[model samples]
Target: MLAIRTKNLGKEFWRQKKASGLLGSVRSLYQQDKERVVAVRSLDLEIAAGESVAFIGPNGAGKSTTIKMLTGILHPSYGEAQVLGLTPWQERQRLAFHIGTVFGQKSQLWYHLPPADSFFLLGRIYELDQRTFEQRQAELVERFELKEFFHVPVRKLSLGQRMRAELAAALLHAPQVLFLDEPTIGLDVVARQSMRNLIKEINSLGITVFLTSHDTGDIENLCRRVIMIDNGNLVIDQSINSLKRDHLAAKIIRVRLEHPVEGLPPIDGAQVLKHKGAGLKISLDTKKLSVDELYMRLRQLAPIADITIGDPPLEDIIANIYRHNQGGGEGHELEQEVAQI
Candidate 1:
């Protein structure tokens, strides 16, 4: 079943026109000139139940606007959308029971109260029974390791601890879908990894996960599929593997040799990026030379002590995609609006 779907969904905003000179400013005030800005334009998307998808884009690319529309926080200017079979704007109250949202920059928990208090309030809002709420609360508190600080005031807990409590509270009512916006932003390395693991666990339990993050690690580790937008237009929609393979069309090979290498052998698509006495870093274009063929040639160089071949960093791949789209004018139709997502 489709957990989320949209067809030609779009949003627009109007800004009052400003005049530079005194007379023009006075005329503008009297006339009230305004210009229409399209934040999202003709977006069509679908996400399946139990799927983990990353919705990514550059700043002001309408990622936040699209998510807001989906969550019923904002109504679209045109077109239609459904979240878990309910029109989000039409059935927002009902949909609230089945969906949870987490924004890294925003706090859903009360600053002065302990997380336990917030959890109970959420349970009441979701209409969960007393027994059920307590059982779920215990499970979340245990799973999130909140015993040490569960009763601590939210303002006093560390960012990592507070985020953990936040996730636990969001899951207290067992939502069917979760919308996560930069859930690991500002977290330490360990805290980020912990958050990613917890999100993966949530997805494994069959809740649809729609994630938006600037951190490439989140996209690489958490999402199977990626849907990217730019300037409010759909730019790319494909699986993560396909996105890397098709867009970048290259790989990085690190080889540690048994002996020092004076120079690399002639290979059509292979470029030696770095070479030390016994280590080599090579970038290979898969379109011109196959990985197996490159491996065979590398083996011919010397008896290899060790080798590791992997894709280029996801940041590079995403940058490449963005450059291609921008140079090709793929998403220039929608006026770039200043937005925070």
Candidate 2:
């Protein structure tokens, strides 16, 4: 069964055109000139049940618009969509019963009340019986380790503690599909990993996870698939492994040497991106030279003090995709048939 599906789903808005200066401002009262701005254009997507997928893009890329349409908060300008076999806009009330949402920047919990109170409120809203609510609440509190701060006022709870409570509240009713937006935005390292583990456990229980986050760590740690969009256009939809294998041909390595050298000798298939006192950064093509091979060559040149190797930033990977798709055209259309679910 498909958890979410869309075909040619799009959204448009009309912005009132205004001219500059005081004279233009005065004339705007009499003249109403508007321009059509497309937020999402001809988007098609399919997400299978129990799949954890990341919907990602830069700012103003229509990611929020698309999510709004899916959650029935905003109606689309054209096309159609379905979430869990029901039309979102038309069946919003019923849809609300089966889906859970968590936004890192926003809070569904009551600010003045404790998380326990909010959980009770949510249970009542979701129509969960007393016995069932208590059972689920106990399970979540223990699993999320919320016993330490569960009764504290939400306003007094730390960001990490509050996020844990938020997740627990969202799951109290046992939702089938969980939509998370920047779930780990301001969390510390240990807190972020804890949240990721909880989310993974939720997905393991057969719930579909739809996540959107700018943190590459969140994407790498949680999602099995990636759906990238830009300028309100579908750019790529493929498995995470496929995305890495196809686009991540080069690996970046930054090494700190124990002692500075006069000049480091070059190695085949590796480009020295940066070199300074006791520090060197290199880009290596895995297709031409293995990482171990480059490490061996580097060891002969200088004693390594500290070294770290990983893929380039996610933004760079997306830029590479854009370059490959439109051939570096600024306004070119991305009409290529890329991978899909």
The top-ranked prediction according to TM-score is 1
Off by over 4 Å in 1: 16-33, 261-268, 292-305, 336-341
How many clashing residue pairs, candidate 1? 0
TM-score of each: 0.88, 0.86
Predictions in order: lDDT = 0.90, 0.88
Top-lDDT candidate index: 1
Per-residue lDDT of model 1, residues 1-341, tens digit only: 99999999999988776668998878875577677788899999999999999999888888999999998989999999999999999999999999999999998999999998999899999999999999999999998999999898999999999899888888988999999999999999999999999999999999999999999999999999999998888988999989987877788999998899798767899999999998999999999998899888977878889999888999999988777767757347667454321
Clash pairs for candidate 2: none
Candidate 1 local distance difference test against the native: 0.90
- Model 2 spans with C-alpha error above 4 angstroms: 253-261, 264-269, 276-279, 286-310, 313-315, 319-341
Q: Model 1, residue 245: displacement in angstroms?
A: 2.5
Query: 1-341 in candidate 2: lDDT tens per residue?
Result: 99999999999887677779998899888876676777888889999999999998777778999998999988999999999998899999999999999999999999999999999999999999999999999999999999999899999999999999999888998989999999999999999999999999999999999999988788888999999887788877998888887899899999998898778776888999999988989999999999999888888978889999998876678767755655535543422222211
